[model samples]
Target: MLNRYNPHAMHQGYYRYPTISGDTVAFVCEDDLWTVPVEGGIARRLTTSLSMVITPRYSPDGQWLAFVARDEGHPEVYVMPAEGGEPRRLTYQGAERVEVVGWTPDGDEVIYNSTAGRPPREVVLWRVSLEGGLPTQYPYGLANHISFGPNGAILLGRHTGDPARWKRYRGGTAGVFWIDRTGSGEFTRFQPTDGDLTAPMWIGERIYFVSDHEGIANIYSCLPDGADLQRHTHHEEYYVRYPSTDGKRIVYHAGADLYVLDLATGENRLIPVELRSPRTQAQRKFVETDKYLQEYTLHPQGHSLLLTVRGKPFTMGNWEGAVLQYGEPQGVRYRLSRFLNDGTRIITVSDASGEPCLELHTPDGVTRFEAFDIGHPYRLEVCPTADRIALSNHRFELHLFDIEQRTLQLVERSEYGMIEGFAWSPCGRWLAYSFAPNERTHIIKIYDTETGAIHPITQPEFRDVLPAWDPDGEMLYFISLRDYDPVPDNLQFEMAFPMGMRVMAVVLRKDIPNPLLPPPRPFEETK
Candidate 1:
């Protein structure tokens, strides 16, 4: 087991894009290139560029190393000797982003992917000769990463969706495909599944790849024809990312530590690579907080503004007072800071006690209230009466907490799904919320505290949301998608309803007149 607390351990983090060639493995660590032996030992820094460098690939013959560097303010390809020397610049197309895929089998050229002079969503592969010249674009349209097979066919990994953002994604563009490079534009997709698959490596008779079909991503191997599939690694904690093979051994990263898998014995072993460079990035450094302002809200009396900067809450004056930070303890995260009814006390949800709890900040200091630990709460709302708090949990159960009595109450539980868009009335005697009866449309509903009655305000014909109570306690206002003005398409004559929403107000009493109607004029007495 790797000691995570040790600073000098191989699991110090920030190592990425591992490429193996013979007995050496080159990878990017903190905007520089470094190489370690396959058996694992002290790593030697190869490039000391000021800018960010990434995606290092060793030449097929192990004589040169090609990687992407942002020295000129944009990513471009550069090649250097395998034993650490001056890097020669390649690819002058000036792309905003470029990545070194791998070297051509002959070692005289390098294959890379770039998004230059094309749409941002599209990436085209190119081959640039090591002797320095313009690149030749491959015919493949949107390939992200590629590896050449023994027969010159290309094994492509296309990211139709973001792998990191969308976990356990099983969409149309989540699998690897084989592209015949012999002028045939013929493409064959791999086995179909609803799991994310990537990092295609064609080694010998088997094609190795990474798949999350078994819950967590692990190394898997299959034949060239997508037959005889087998799982190689059974890691369940962290996903095995960026696996590279030099035909003899497979190297990959699992939870910040590199592991090497011998193809002959199928034995996986950890490679303890000790980094000798100055650990400048792990040290503490000062950062300007004004640029990272996230959430802000106006003060109740409009005298100041409540702002959250880098998880710390602050109050800045509208015209007079200076900025005052809440000065919470370090390592504590406070979210959704809100002012109570009097504006003298601030209420926020914090995880300072390990689990999330409600905290009250006032002139008397901070006081924590333990109101029925439901783990972490969301969409916390303070009542106008200042004695009750409303919130929802991850399980979609709405709750109400009595501040003074230190008691909890279950407001409403959704049997169909989650109930959202809840608001308190001015008198704090009722709560209005919206939920979908079916899965099609959301309807507004009101809950009365005095009568304990729940009834729907709107029908199921349209979706209504964001309910707000009128200050006079006589009307309710909400947004509804009832307007259906459809615009015809110019090319196909198809009608498209483009987000027609309107604000609507409903009188709580039956005797109330329409607010938008013209008022009646008084008649003069017959004189």
Candidate 2:
């Protein structure tokens, strides 16, 4: 029950990998992905991915299972069959999305990193061909944490020049190169007498890397000819991520959890894991659902609310700065708005010309009000008789603005394929939505503001849809995924899902009126 916006506090063990039968050692507890026996006791599961499989690795003859799935849409690179089915994609199209960072000792080939169209802040290594087609550019220069070495040699996190301006001689630099898989030049470079080294592991002649130099970042080893540079573990404020290995212990990520280290008794364990779950969080606090609320809006007497968030230095200003601020206090990206029909004002999204509109506040100031250019708009609704303002669009569409005739209207278009939540009924004329398509199905449908036609209802099972309608509009309250993914006698995520399958609720029309029937109240206010 510890979910004050949940920030870690629920982890068991397992996590650590290296099997392909080097005697066995793979771990990822609960939703499947295990493999112990490196001389220990029981532990076996090895393959599963319905919604989240991650960084698995194994294929130097362990048959095949080179991971990275994220359900689909961004993180790609699959191979499956280490006893699973239908997986094989191995990096496709790309334009800023294709992770699968390393594997090549005769696993046929695999090494990835992307930004598909080339520049979204650099990160471009590619070298596919596991008996398939396309993918072969490992030129070196704009790199990022790739790794290969059992003997094929190739390790990354590079950047020699032209990163729009480069800058770094002592403020946390990052170098660790050594190429030759066909992107030749014998590259060689490792200079980090201290600080700036990330995700580098090879283990044998040494090359364990992950450093903030000595001010934090920990786990270091080096010797790809850079010679004896040891410094293996002295944490300091926890930050390491991705430093893996299977040649007998070494795995990383220290605050997004997951940790291990035993390259011969320097012990460090904490494999009670999480691995990578901070898409964004800092002094965090979150909760929103006017159908996934984001751009803010809702007044005309439905109580109050107009939040925006990203204020007070929420960060951004070091692309070597020259007037490149994105969001935060000074940029005014904060929109903790509130309204219940003109008793006040408050609405914000900010950053107008660079797109992300709407602004209108009132402690007596801020009044830019334009609306939707989209960069993350999420569920906002206001329609009291079509005075309009509907929103939700990270490309699932929906739109519909008119805020007193300013003009706009896309009106709806998700097609049961990736629109996570939406609602509008209280007499504003029928809307209710929620979808997903394949994390085990999550439908919901229902549109029709005067016959634009939709109507789906129930027929979605397997958790997480989220909609909530009926303050007098027939009924709809969502969340589903009842049970499936709880195998953690010790952490696991080889292909995640099953760490407790959350999000549940269902009732198509028991006479409507269960807006989540009382079960969430108490955010501290007990006088």
Scored against the true structure, residue 209 in model 2 reaches a CA lDDT of: 72
Expressed as tens digits, the lDDT of each residue in 202-285 for candidate 2 is 667677776564565667776766677877677666555555566677665454445556778777655432333222323355
Residue-wise C-alpha lDDT for candidate 1, range 1-527, written one tens digit per residue? 22233336454656777888888988878789988997778889998897998778888888899999988778899999999999999988878768887877788999988898886667778899999898999877788777766656667777732344466877666655554544255777665344687777788777787888888887778777777888878776887877777778778777766777777777777667788778777677787866887777777788888887778888889988788878475688878787887888888888887888888899999988864675567677778876777787766677787777887778777665566678899988888887677777888888886686888899988888888998888899999988899998676669977768999998999988888898886687556
How many clashes (backbone N, Cα, C below 3 Å) per candidate?
A: 1, 23
The Cα error of candidate 2 at residue 217, in Å, is 4.0
What local distance difference test score does each model get?
A: 0.78, 0.57
Positional deviation of 366 in candidate 2, in angstroms?
A: 16
Cα deviation of 515 in candidate 2 (Å)? Answer: 27
